[model samples]
Target: MKLRTLLIAALLAMPAAVTHAAEPIEGNWKTASGATAAIAKCGGGFCITLKTGKHAGKRIGQMNGAGTDYSGSITDPETDKTYSGSGTVTGSSLRMKGCVLAVLCKSQTWTRL
Candidate 1:
């Protein structure tokens, strides 16, 4: 009976372990413009907090960004707007996407740096 209980407990814990083992998005990525953006995990998702710009050598403030609970966003710096988005870590790539205003924006894939 004790062995059976132990087995059941282990089985129940497996899913949680797997979920916790999921990879986090915390690295540098190149934008479509060839600019580098720093991504990090936040609010159960990920966010872009920095980007390459004219002031590349200057210290810029953090990017006020947010993403979904299991996804992230790639913002357009020029527009100062963010689309709804999510991301997945696959191999050496961070696949992301965002919905445009009243439009279905395609996934924007970024390679991990």
Candidate 2:
């Protein structure tokens, strides 16, 4: 009886372990505007930064630099606008959508680079 209980407990733990696997954002990505986006884990979540491109003739990069925690608004180089939202990693893709001032302003699909 004790052995059976232990076996069942072990089995239950396996699923939780599997679900804790790293998210899909730990990689490089390409934005729609011919720019690069480097994604990695940040503050127990995920953050994406511009690796290369130009915004107002200045080299566009992450506001907090590399490996910084992201919370709140993020600027999109393509549209040149700041969006407020979050993202999720799904099967080699990071889907991010944000609103500008309570309006569903933009969304983007970034492929693994």
Could you give candidate 1's per-residue lDDT for residues 15-58 as a string of tens digits?
99987653446678775556676765555544565567642432
RMSD of each: 6.6, 7.3
lDDT of 1 at 52: 73
Give candidate 1's error at residue 113 in angstroms: 1.0
Per-residue CA lDDT of candidate 2, range 5-75, in tens?
A: 99999999999998876545566777667677776566645556677777433322232222222335567
Model 1: what TM-score? 0.55
User: How close is every model to the real structure, measured as TM-score?
Assistant: 0.55, 0.55
Off by over 4 Å in 2: 1-21, 55-72, 78-81
Give me candidate 2's TM-score against the actual structure: 0.55
